[model samples]
Target: MPNIEYIITAEFHIDKGPSLVFQYPHQLPGLQNLYFLPELMLPDQIHKRNEDYTLFLLYRNLNTGEFQYLYNKNNCEPDPYFLYTIVLNLTNDEYKRGSQVKSLSILTNLSFFKNFKPVMMICLDLYFKSNDHHIIKQLYKSINEKSFIISRDSLNGMEINDISLIKKLLITSILDLPINDKIYYDENFRNKILGIGKSQIINPDLFIRKDLSFNSILNFNEMNIPIRIPMINLPDTIGDYLNPTDLNFKPNLINILNSKLSSSILNNELTIYGLQTPPIIILINAILTGKKILVMSYENSSGYIIDHILLILKIITGGGILSGLLTRYNIFPIIDVSKIELLEECDSFIAGTINPFFKNNDKLWDLLYDLDLNEFIISSNIETPGDNIIKSSIISEDARFLSNLQLSIFNYNDDLTTIQLIFRRHINEIIRILLSSKNFNNNLLPNNKDLILLLEGIGYYWSSDTTKLLEISCYQLISKKFQNLLYNEKLIYNLILPNLSNELNLMIDLHYHLQSLNNVSITTKINEREIWFNILKFLISGKSLEIFLLITYLIPPNSSTSLQSSIAHNGNITIFDKNKGIELLLINLFNFDDQIKSNIIMILQELEDNFLCGWCINLFLKNNLIYEIAFNELINT
Candidate 1:
């Protein structure tokens, strides 16, 4: 059992905002104590009068003082007793004289207090001096039914106070109290307690009795649905490839497809041995149009064929275009010939390389022969099985249109089997279109970096070939476009120079090509500065010593002077003034490890006799290069 001693007190002042203040004299012995003052706004009638008020403090607790044994046995019901009453008479002479005679005191034994029993309640009555307004306010409110005691004694006799439980009980008792109807109906009182105005309160009974529907509240039939407008107007040439029957076709899909098709056409030429035969755009178009497609290849070639097939499937299923609606259609990729039974269920079959076992096996061959040739599209690399070879037909009409357009432009022939030849034939036209495209003008080309990288690939692919035509073609096209695009000097020095070529002569040739442009004005001084900067960048990137030595030999002695002049011109400072370039280089040198610092020291040593070397040496001497101290020690010896 647990015990609690409480001397609870409350005071009401007419002038105070809260009007009522409650206090507990004795700390609750072991249980948590909670006091609640709702602080609700009093009605106008209560505030208007200077009248006397009386509050009856009614407490109902059974007396168990003489019935201890009965309480222990839980056998007898205890008798209830009235605790006390408090009075406030503002009209009294003492109150008029500012003595404030409003006070209440209660002392009682509540040893028999139990849970789920009404322990206390308060009744308030306001009386006016005038007979016109007698009993201006009256309220009978119940206290919490649950006793304040949270828990009884445990084995260790430790009491854990649960303040939250007490607070919840007190709040529920306060809300359940029957306030006067006048106060409950008052807008101000309702707002103060419920946090909502009377007009905002919904009446379920009123709504249920009335006939109402969504259509009655809103004129749905008269509402206009807004139409979506495309961001860009697609050209009719590419628009012809769009599926006319696709109701779900959207502008964004058309834009993406157009961009891809345009980029592919600009970068690659149509060829029989192209990595993606029939083109990815054509495959997308085929799926969009619900056309049947068959793909066949040998087991060895199946992997590469399947890769392309999976890429298309991923595009469709990933909701890049049709929002995965194409998955509902019958589409399947048959990789294993053993699962030939599943092929009958598919509207289209992407038949990968036939297993080698079927080559000599008559039974398997017969089964494959039974597969409709019209529904089968064979890989270009594999030889047709029967005397009447089943040539893969273009399933989508739009795909055929695009293919014909490519063939007409490039003049496809046996000699033009390689992508390089096809690209070479269409290079000039591709360049013209790319340079004039909206993406090029806006600098929003999605694969601009990829296009630049392709130039490098082309150059390397034909590096050992006796015929340097393809490599030269790649260089010319890249050089022409990059001349216009390389607006940022850092971009040209960092990205363009290294990727142009590994050969010293080719790099020099490209630099000269940029310089020789009629519109371009790359001075001898600016060119020299860029060359040294590129060499430094290359060396820092961990290039071989051979390349570094070659670059060192190629760099003119006045390269540093040229750099100083360029920096001076840009900053509008004299070249003779303190060298910012050397300061910047010194700052960067601190970032390098001891090994790289030593390498830089050696490079500077090779150029020591040159005029630029004096500035570099001064920089090293002024700033501590850690390696500088080691170099000085070696020099002194």
Candidate 2:
């Protein structure tokens, strides 16, 4: 048990009397509980502030073992009662220091830990940022100044002592280390860290190693080279123009951004490329508009566009034309003589890819925020996006790593269709901001992509990535941006709306739709699924459709065959089939109580809807999966 000691937590009356009784220290605190020791020790004064009662805890001195007046201060500030949810700085300071500091600390009231002394840990959130060394040094200084080291123990309690007395402070500082000392490029170390394993003892000498290098082009680093953002969005896109009020880049790259702006949900895959491209910035003269941009080109239909791209490329203006055939694979390899074979296989028209915005300062980033790049003047058009990609190509998961050894000028990071657009729209802006970053111009490739994606997966860390750790990060915008993409009248009316295409185009459209569907809003889900079925139905007649489904295994036999079969069968709206609607409903009812497996069966049986009731039985038989969700678990062998 952690701790359940009561100090003081007086607040608005509940049942006119007391709170639940606290039995242990780590147990959850509720109504009238006298928790002896809790993970979160609030200040006594605040806890007992006339009806401001909350869970309590006792902090014992590490050296003397004497108890101090540590009580539940959770009920102190603006939202005292909701202190657990507060995002505080990782520093030992649990109290409010400022609004910008987002912390990670959890304090559990002791009620659940019956007899065992509860265990509590000070939570630390880390976000990846290149200049972590300065922050870490500050943190080390804070530790030296305020909190002391302690031999944590469940047997007794946290024993305090001078951190110096403890020899090794044991304070984890992977994300906070100086860039040179940071081992992010070390593949082995990166793998371990990605797996969330404990890092080895960082050698003091190695922690200050000046021999390491940080390269941005992936030529000699353990990370992928970032295509200079300046080259992509154009430097002047965000800078002041001649008039400061005139430019013609329509709220430009809107729909190209993550599909969440509309809240209509499209593609659960936000931040797929690791670049935090927001939807609003993709619009009509987005660079000109101070705050909002909504641009998605309604130039052509998918089928017609494919044909047109082919036609346009046939009469190439003296260069290799772009095509899916060129950038078909997922493994984008680093370019170099050694990786030539990799490039040959990709057949990409990658050529002349450069980060036109190449500098080593924060000036460009700040400039963009303060100025307008699109309004500025430029002498010539950027080398047609990634002409360098034309000269280079490879699709490998380790392209980021492999490219470190090869001086590759272009990246197959984006697909043929998406790449040209990303480059055409945002290259300059990206370059402008990137130029301002020290990490951008360093020997090391700006491996910020790795950091960004990693943070996306693990939430925050001890310290987080700088661009990612903003007040409103790109993640928050993904949903809204995606929604806006779907509703973009031009995109729908032109590309996806016409409903003119053979099965292939339809399939391509369906795949894109599916890709966007992951984040689809509830409002659009049924229609989207219907759209998928309609597309599939057009595949063939009843018997032909069944035959095709069998050949493709789109409609697998049952879950007992394989777990993935169940997942694939998820949206079973396959037409030219029986009970398609019923199966769909059963899937809606189907849910994993354990979440990983074991769909709760009763939620289906109890359904009042006839469609749900009928399909429940069939789906159960198909999956052979039971609903273990929050239900009683028992067995008799």
Candidate 3:
């Protein structure tokens, strides 16, 4: 896909103030005379800094008319046509004519648009000097023609085993090597490591890639400049451009409140309803249940608080389920009093404001989070639309889970990343169990009686409002067939579940492939050593749990293996070997609840008693020692 959809420049004039200077290729459909164009380009204070950068989002509405606040009021599903905007400010007296500052921006649908920053910088510099439209035209042509170094088509096949093989090929090249994030900006890893003798040992054509590749350098002959893609990226990290690094990203939810706000206005009251429930729990519930959220702070800039809130949302959902759930399209990171009327036109959003006037009008938001007071102010006019009796169990479950997480977080010396993993896995587990429910039929729609049971059990009410929200939630990460059925008939069965069965089965297949590997002596080549390290890294990665869960879920009496014959007890089959079974179980033992843990102990005890399978018990003991060392290293780091 093309990275740059449109390029435009905005300038601040002493007489006319902020206005669009020019748009490349063709003018954007409805951007001309946009009410918020000034805000998009200049932000709060553009002249304060010598140079500045701002990020914003807009939808591709082709109206080309007056502002319509109610455009997407009915549907909250992610708009597939959302555009991310990056504005680069050049504040200097060198600019021509009536403006001292000019803002250059690229509007792209890519969440990884940060990669194109270098290109943007050069383009802006060149445009400033030459004032040639052809430079922008050449950039548009070159970016669109750029292709992935490796074929992405290898992952598009129907057979997951084939996809798994492709993943193995991709991951193994990066295997056993501590990711050199430096590679994202420097010369290629192969070129950096390979001397004359080493070059012969390693294949020159072999590709070593990362989860995100930010170092893809592009050359524009027309402009006579080369630029490397930038490093920073948006929250959604699962894309072709993802560049996995050695350093693990640990987002601390407790520290989500802006330091400026918290330091100045720290409050003892972090609860609601006279100290019964934590405000965070209420906030999570509000977001999950599809309520309009407005976070208000009178402190300096609203950007920090807004960014932190977005980070909190991203962390809670693990960047997987929330990818298409809510995005920049659904948020206004910075809001002022002037946009209040437009904000009110939308039925739902999560907005941040420095303006105190928003608090005076309670009807403006369904849930108002006051950073100054450290309180959650639930609007009196807003209420959850469902039977309280039926919702009790669901509410309890959510509260129990979140409260446990909150309590455990503060009480432990454990790694914050580990806690994040546990939180994410909990969410994935919920999706897995929901999709595996017997209440849903072959068509993937739930039966009425069982549907209500499913809904109530998972904390949803059976109503039109819930259904609409569900429809919006189900739009992303689902098959086209499911999406088609959902759009045609608004329903709950398609809600929030990401075809878990297929994903789990893929993990299982990948596990089977891993087991199929034969033991071999370590190779002497640097490339071979690098591959080994990458593999080990993958084993310890947070994402590795997907494959690990397949082992945990099919343990005890149900354990089975590909190399060995499937062991059956009471119609359930266990797959894989005893050593792998033990390794997998030990790796994710913490993720399992009490009941599952108890069953695993019983199964291990049975293996311990049998003289023939006694070696399995010894292997388990041996692996546990290695696991402890690795665990301690992970925590300490």
Candidate 4:
């Protein structure tokens, strides 16, 4: 059995923004009494105009603090019908752009002494649909009972301004803005305060420690990247089908037997013949062309910087060369066409337009002749093929021609075993090239960060001694080229944040361990903290509050029971300054989808409780972290 009503009509004014009407009732008082669309629902939307807001009046009896539910003295309108509606004339355009937040007011019709002046209120918490609520608690405080006021137009005696009406309007308006911002209820209510007329309430903890050790020395905060390990199913004791194995290492010899493709084209106008294009050049061109795949290939094939250099070369050369191109293998203008005809039969054709005229000039003709160009060009020694191939085979062919022409002055070793080892093995080729570097061969490592990172990523299990070499190389990075790049306060965070766990106990250990690393780098302490800060910053921030939940597990509010608890105990007020990181964090707060912002604020509250105290509230009262960044970020978005 339910109580049903017929048409209950009431009149209001267009004050600021749009309006929403629910058939049953609205929750928030003032303009917010219209919030009952969710709890009750006489659904209708009222839009806003000229960047203003609508104010509503929910009256209360002077003697009884309860809202007067009657509308008029005659009782046709119940005492509860004392609510006033504030509306704003808004068409679709205002809805598309923004929710014009003008001033908020209480109803002015009631008769009391027209006393104190009224103060304007701004409603900001949830957009009808956005999830960001990082500042919800702050907004609630802004409209606290002690914050707002109302008076007559003449600043004389006020007509009507009820505290209950204001409080009701504020509580409901902040709780539910344009829509239900989903974040508040998530995270098990870790970051938000609950209940009114406060007494003893539920205080629940939301995290599970991944590490159980009280005195464990593992520094979880000193970790940058998540550890990736293959998980196994079942095989004697659970085997992995997810990763690598020995059986997969065998190469496809079919590729070796097939003819390799070429890049040059001996076309109508431009001619580039017998020129070997460097792999570096190909890579560089790929970068300039925005060929991501080629850039990736270059990184895997060589070092990233070297790949970058090669990419540069490619851009400089314009689609230059590839391996095993007959057109680039020193074919003179008059050389045998018959020989090239046979090469073309293999679904491959080489072209000219490759420029290395510096080497092909008469200055190198005698040198080329001495190197036996005819042998490379014709590839025909029918009767004596076997014996000649044994002495001067194609084994060192790519190297020799490249060297004699001065295209690449690479030294070639006659050791057949070494060349054979590198033929189809990328690693072996990389090692050979590394050894070929005059500096590297002399035990001098290059001070390149990208190279070191790439080497580190190769991982120890994949290559034992080589992996050790790469790790050792990282230490050498202490030289000038690195120039303390990794030491950046924000950059060093690669050391903090556990791979997949949240535990403060681990952070303490990390702090202690980082203290030990003082011998490695005097900056270890600050670096560790900096990294941890970054992780926390990211965890508690984003378009949503997912990071906050993750961060809560790291720094729990009850961290030191013996310590003085302030609201935001670790709430370093430094970021509150404009142009600082915290300012940026606040700015991003407005952009979060309702669901995400709610979750984050709720998550932060877990630690917020331990921090919430007279001092903390005092701090919040002074926490003017809002700046140009926050305002601009929201405006731009």
Whole-model Cα lDDT per candidate? 0.27, 0.22, 0.43, 0.22
lDDT of 1 by residue, 113-229 (tens): 211011121222222232211111111111111122322243433222222221211111121112223223543542322222333432221111100100011111233222111
Off by over 4 Å in 1: 1-268, 271-295, 298-441, 445-526, 534-637
lDDT of 4: 0.22
Q: Tens digit of lDDT per residue, candidate 4, span 290-335? A: 1211111111211111222222222222111111111112111111
lDDT for model 3:
0.43
lDDT, candidate 4, at 257: 18
Q: Identify the runs in model 4 with alpha carbons over 4 angstroms from their true place.
A: 1-476, 479-501, 504-575, 612-621, 625-637
| TM-score of candidate 3 against the unseen true structure | 0.55
lDDT string for model 2 (148-216, tens) is 111223344332211111011011100112322333446443322222223323211111112221111
TM-score to true structure, per model: 0.16, 0.16, 0.55, 0.15
Span of 10 residues, lowest total lDDT, candidate 4: 231-240
Rate residue 340 of model 2 by lDDT.
32
Please give the TM-score that candidate 2 achieves against the real structure: 0.16
Q: Which of the two, 3 or 4, has more lDDT? A: 3
Residue 531's lDDT within candidate 1 is 34
**Backbone clashes, each candidate:** 4, 158, 22, 89
